[model samples]
Target chain A: MKRRQFIRTAGATVAGIAAAPYILPSGSLFAATGNRRVGHVVFCMFAGGVRNIETVHMNDGNLLPNLITGAGGISPDILGGMTALPAAAAQSLQTFGTVFKEFRYAQGPTGHFNGHTTAITGQYTQVDLNLRERPEKPTVFELYRKHNNPATSALNAWWVSNGLGPYPSLNYSNYPGYGIGFGANMIAANSLVNADAYSVIGNTKNFTDPQLAKAAALRDFLDQQFKTLTPDSARLNTASDETRLKLFINSLYTKAFSGQFNDPLQTGPGVMNGDLYNIAFAEEVITEFKPELLVVNLQGVDVCHSNFTEYCDNIRKSDYAVRHLWDKIQATPGMANDTVLIVAPEHGRNYDPNTLIDSYGRRAFDHTGDASSREIFCLIAGPSSVVKQNQLISTNMGESIDIVPTIAWLLGFDSAIPSGLLPGSPLTAAFN
Target chain B: MYIHKLNIVIITLVIILGMLVSACKKKETTYYYEVPDAAVTGSSVIKPNQKSTLEYVSILYADLMGQSIPQPELTRMVTAYEAFGDDRIIEDLIIRNLLNRQDADIPTTPEMRANPTQFVDAMYQRFLVRKPNDYERMYWVQQIQQDTSLHPDILYYAVLTSAEYRHY
Candidate 1:
């Protein structure tokens, strides 16, 4: 039977029990206290400081009748690719039922690392740029795994990155009592592609002799590197649970390398090479794993620093990628009616263009020190479909950090969980 | 009946011969560039100014790139170290990996069947770049040895995945 059909049947059977309202214990602030509304949550980081001018506000100021204007609402354009708007509209276009059009990262540092860090932890602290350091607090991934899968061993969550940087270390945090054990599985998709040749070497731990098999050769090589490398001090879990995750990761690498799943690079829509490829991998994960909490980071829009023309081009492509990802999720056997997709840029770009010009003779842009860098938008859709169509919540000044609490709430964590761990609140308007 | 029995015998012989032939065919050889190790004399002593820095850099490079370090890249790193008197190549490569599109491959080790302390010590040397403190060694040894089912390879993997592996 299809996973969605089984979920529907099971949901129907448990509707009555799930509907009963019950208050959480006042003392247990970190534990989950509510019924799950959605079985899966896809949090797209939408990184690299997307600008409003070329994105949501592309219809305004320039005086052009952009496709966003044709869509009948000024706000829906922020969704970029969720709508039925043409990808080549005078501007990028996407449709969704609800948009926090005037959403703002009212708190936190506006740098790339800070924006993404806040997106995960929901606090706007000034973090060091140490590649080895994780957020000092409990991240949403940790809380979700701890509360939702306390006793289970299923791979419940993952964080996939378009590129490798400090981002891979964000899977968990340095919070006491909550660290690697509660971390999400992270995959740098670009790196996975490069390592394709090595994943088939088999599990090195299983081999007993150095000359017996390829596994031994791999083991010998790894041993040499291990002995000579200066270790990063970050702690990781090596318990039986972690071992399970490692095995699972190996399986994913093997599958990805085998080309059993679709690779955007091989079948791209004629454009979008970097971040779009990551989005395709994210889609594949949703279809294959159906992880309960999945976060994907895409940063191709950062190219705006030196190539505005390509940046604009990428913005349009990003719109299409989002739509494609959503469509894939909808078509997946288990995720169609069981997932909630939340999309938001980490932060926005500077208001004015930089002096640099691309080969296309277009003005380049940067996000360094502009107040407009704080401008951002968000869209939430699906599963409950509780949100009214074309709904706009412009009055609420939201922080990037609020996404974590909102995600926690959507996944059935107690209200206290967010209140205790985050400095922001849920996007309450999207819920029933 | 006698012809049927002969047919069955012949079929079984064919299957056994095919298995033997396939098994005896030349085994496919796997190639890997061996990373040189820094010799540690005592349980806690490490050779200073050892080649461990380059090895560490390669792993970090692989971690970010998601593949083994290409020979040219490795040569460039070694050359940079010779010229600069430091392994700053690691930092430069890390930044390059983050800024560009690439992949990586982390090497794997054999499981520790016994001698949990020795295995844990090896991990501390491999990933932590030092010997485990007395307390850490004792604790890990106790943890793994008592739980014989615990795989030592898991511990090594855990360290590789740690925050320590990422930062200076």
Candidate 2:
């Protein structure tokens, strides 16, 4: 061969040799040794266009007191200057783990759905108004389900959405090699378990155990026959898991009717909203399943679009709910001391207030994808042994796309998924 | 002369009976019956695309209620149904809820047990929009025949939530 031809051939041979192993082995990209720091992770997309002025900024820092640390960025007097909050079980989350106060969403239109897509898929997305469409890339749930050691099922991956819209579709994607079957089990907690739903499905027939068994058996037979013709008829959960879910749903209905769910959140000051109810129900899920990967988004703060005062109030309530979630996780038997809770707003709100002003003379804001809107914060809190304690980073250290890879790394299977798929790496500073 | 008279009487009675038999046979009409023609092709192939949430709820309502659901009710059911992530569990609960309603247009257990094939064929046409293949017909028919605990409500629930029925 001529010299030029020899160089081209050698390059192709070497590239092929390097790629052959990852393509052949379905295990790990770098053959990782499976050792995990934490067994459970709860990713909270603390969304609804949170602005830094209300949060990390010490002047107006009462909004997220549970998260902001009184270290280098703010003086202790700022926290002391704020009105006292209701006493809670745990201390500041930042004291328990690391906080990146100036984290950036990096690239993407600051739409709520786009922010969610970035956080869940770990990839920046272009503006797409179709909130109902699945992400173009595999979700962290799919990657974990497909690549984790000692393969797990759908129940282990749970997503609890505050309301509706695109929240339901975030559990899975239309990406090839991953779809509904490998998707996470999700529930729009507020929408699925509420007074409205109770009014309708509350008194549904309670099938006898034997009758349910017969129906399940018959369904399996029909499903098997149908699967022969249509391969994709298979669903995410298995038969037994499906039964468990059915019973769980039934129990929710029972609770709704049995007077067990009598205004769990207080009315005045307690701020009964979908976001609070969402985390409340997610606590129920954690109690039941103790899922390995749980993603629950709270967006009550999005009211900033119209009511600034309510938004601030919601911020306070949202902080309380988040802290409550952390406390509940600590109290749960299996998840206590073993779970990592990662909370971050999907994106920030516009710096400039909108035309409307609330009764408190504060103007409402919108997430217009401006500079302020692109700035957000992230808190990675867990047991101090696994996560760094009382550490705070005020500068921009990580991007929104880093969450998936961070989750993969914490779960100890980062090398299993193709690194090229996730441009972001684990936020190592948060961990030891 | 007397024996000849008796033989004539017997031959006359035989001719009268033959005429009566032929007339009775002509009065009866011969006809054939088959299953109602399916809106879709009568084959084993299923619809290519799955039904949307609205479509599934509408068709399921129509199939069970034997009438179109009201617009408000359709929206309500869809909202509640879409709330749950697992379609299987939600579908089961809804199916059971609908089956318990007084308006649920399912065949009575006696009606189903009386003629298994007719009930199975009606269900296939109602939900799947096609006839059940031989194996399906045989299996379900046998199941209905042998299984004393089989309830027509569950039979309807099974076929309604079947993978094939999820499509057009």
Candidate 3:
């Protein structure tokens, strides 16, 4: 009669039913190989901090004038200067109107490292030292990799960025040797390193007759090498290391086939619009793998620290990248039916006029002060008509702890996994 | 015995079905306040008790500028009062002046250094507009001299709450 007893009995029944293959068609077997009950998620983490007044709650037109109809003190020329983009790019911004309607601001500890960790883990801790020394917590990526069906060749989750310090220290993530520095290096490496013959076979999608033969041959060679090179004494270590290596190799081929493997050429200099790169990369991955879940943290907005003049401009660019990702997913096959995109900032900037001036005369206010500085937007968009359109969720009472459990709920995971680390409730307004 | 076994199996199945149904049903107990549309509406009404202390000081400077008070008289009054009260009021005015200027540098001339009465009078004219009640003015003057450890924020809040600061 109790909930646990009920779940155990139901789970046993479902397990018995699921073990039988006679109930499924031959084509359904392929669906079973991939995650049949899985839901795909593309998360856009607006790294660094975005001012709440400027992006989400900009009722006044001081920061972004274009967002307002009749402005107050801001000049028209300055507003136009901030948004001088092509018409097609400008139109893409509207797809996010529904997303912005469901926006919820997240609050947490104010530093860059702490904010980033909280954004992924949905747990707040004062991690002042290096991120590697921080306590372990399960990220959304870790959860998916642990529970999702593993017959697929590619990685179930990836952490890619142009330059965002170190990846969150979660045990289950597949860190694809890509950082801000490595992103540039990878781009350059692509141009210099010739494609290997083995890589060429992996890049093609000709899975019929001859290609099938080639796949079998490659699998056989690897199996024989795996046997001779790795003894049974070190099987566990060798297997894990080999699995990681295969994942890396498969990711490279996935990139090559998608045509994004060629080093992304920087147009001028500096950090080459990481927001734009993340958008392009997510699009390529969705098209190739149609992954059950993906997380991409865009870092160009943090360039505000370098020069305040670029802050608004970077925000607009990041907004456009998010819109583009959503639009592509809506158009992609199979994904159009059941994918959801959640976009949010890791933290926010201080609005106090005192600390607004930096060494370069740039506005660098305190981000750890009152509630305003801690406010940053969270947006969710999906095919499921769950949330009411154009609805706003007040985040004053919410904390950074709600995100992971909310994500798990949306993915239909059993809530029995007590999210003790996250003490807040899910944003039920986001669901039907 | 056979009938008992059947009853147990049926009970287990019923319980399992109940769990699935309950779990699938959305949680209805959570409550959220729908964000009001009026929060984002634009208006031009001047809010009461919202002018910061720094803004009040700027009003004082504007009044002095309007009346063409000599720099020496203004500096003397401000400096003499600076020693009697919290230093942040005088400090805030100096900082505001530097920020508003194109060169972004504070004035350091002797004429600007020795004027306090003229500075106070000018600020009273600009910020108070009409005039402060005799009792209110006396209270402020007495408090400034007596309260040497007041924080800038508290001073600003006090100024904002004043009737003269509210109307102007």
Candidate 4:
């Protein structure tokens, strides 16, 4: 080969080798060691906040009448999935998971953005309620992906947020050390379902000659415009990683459009529930990609800010989605055997009811001012061997930030590095 | 058998050449961030002409569709691009949806089929906000002419989904 050609080929080969690890599947990239007990971890952020009264510790049928008694109870799992302290007479304590009913947002700003970020990053940031900025610290996804060194092509981590607002930046952190590239594959579930994005993006087979020409002509036009800007300015992935991710997403979108994977909201009363759609899609992702870590953000229950009846209804739906989502995950072929699921609301609701009432004349509860917002709970469940089912760890006294370290401990990724001055530690007491 | 022999020869050659290249460059690194240095503090690297995210999204939307993208959809588009690493797929879907709208007055099938070059030219004007150069016009016209299966819709989709349409 000519000298110039040889240099070019060698450089390309080196770049390929460097990028190869990130462009491969996680299974082929990292061997499961004895220390790695958890094969997969799913973190479900029951966002928009939930109150302790409505969850974990509902007083008979007083707080949420519908969940406990009204019209023969909407969700059996809501009652079935928790252990009431002292065992309430009307409610049973039998559950499929361990619930930390005494948990609180002991640290961090007490709201959706801060709580969720703290839950994922194991650190607190003073970032305002504005959703403009990503987390300052590395998230559990970035930590797992970076520490484990999964191939970029492997769908190692995903964040399926139910809404688009204040959530656009949470898929990854903006930390200088761990930013853009290492972030999770985020899907704004609401955008996907509500916009019927699947129908438009997934219908690739119908690309007629005319359509291709339009696309090409647009490309040609755009190319000239791009010339005025500085070249190579965009933060682009390695060509291989880009190609693989695009193809994988394209195939998944196709499968979604084909109705191969059933969306719960696609039919019946579930269609009215956005949280259910998010859960169904989360389940689809878990089954399809089998990501090492998956974060599901469901915020429909936040309707309590205005409409109490809708809020209660949404909580019931969210509860059902949670139970159904877990069932689906456990039933999925690869995920069934070994997956750790953590479900927790970002924070809780207000102590006092607001004056404004919904169409049902039921009073609403806001979460911003009251200390009740700090009151939240977490449920951790996985294989019987890993965690004792139906166990309650109320005495552990954990914060939302502890979730990241706990996940790290479970997956045997990186522990909370105290030397680095990170805020939270693993919920080691939750483990057997 | 001959192809296999050629592959083996190429592999060996690549390995030798790669080793030579690596020795010359002691460290190969890709930095995701630029750390500030106190030691070399004076003038800052500035590119004032760089396009803001809003400018990039708005200009493209207005130029292509002759109307502002609804604020909500625009916000979602920006979010999709910023949160997710690549927004090419989202852009394509958005453009298709926008053009397919009833009021978009986008070319009908017959209009696109009758004057293929004219369609391409209009696409350039709408999407790029400039007329297509002779070379671009000729190249696409020739491709469409040569391949009867090549449709005008494909050109529309192409221009709508191009990197230029996405970025400023």
Q: What does fnat come to for each candidate?
A: 0.00, 0.50, 0.00, 0.28
In terms of lDDT, which candidate is stronger, 2 or 4?
Answer: 2
Runs in model 1 with CA error above 4 Å?
Answer: A1-31, A60-96, A149-154, A195-272, A416-420, B1-168
Ranking by DockQ: 2, 4, 1, 3
Candidate 4 per-residue C-alpha lDDT over A155-187 given as tens digits, one digit per residue, 9 for 90 to 100: 667888777666767767777656656677777
> Model 4: residues >4 Å from true position, as ranges?
A1-34, A61-96, A152-154, A195-205, A208-272, A306-313, A352-364, A369-371, A415-421, B1-86, B96-160
User: Runs in model 3 with CA error above 4 Å?
Assistant: A1-38, A59-77, A80-83, A88-108, A131-135, A148-154, A168-272, A353-362, A394-397, A414-421, B1-168
lDDT tens digits, residue span A88-109, model 1: 3342222344567677776666
> What C-alpha lDDT, on a 0 to 100 scale, does residue A126 get in candidate 2?
95
Can you write out model 3's per-residue Cα lDDT over B14-122, one digit (the tens) per residue?
9999999999999889788996443322322223443344444445444424444345544443332222112232333342332344432222323222442333344
The window of 10 residues in a row where model 2 chain B has the poorest summed lDDT is B37-46
Of 1 and 2, the candidate ranking higher by DockQ: 2
TM-score of each: 0.60, 0.82, 0.49, 0.67
Q: Positional deviation of A345 in candidate 1, in angstroms?
A: 0.5
Which residue pairs clash in candidate 2?
A29-A415
Error of 1 at A332 (Å): 2.3
Residue-level lDDT of model 2, residues A1-432, one tens digit each, is: 999999999999999799776652334444455578899999998999898778877545456766765433222433332223465334689889999988999887999999998999999999586957999999999988888876788889998888777778888999988888779998986777766665455557666878777877887887766533444754889989987887787777677677655555433353467877888788878877999999999898899999876777677778878888998999999899999999999999999989998666667899988999999889999988899998989888998999999999889878778759999989998998
lDDT score at residue B136, model 1, on the 0-100 scale? 62
On lDDT, the leading prediction is: 2
The interface root mean square deviation of candidate 3 comes to 37.0
Instruction: Name the lDDT value of residue B165 in candidate 4.
Output: 52
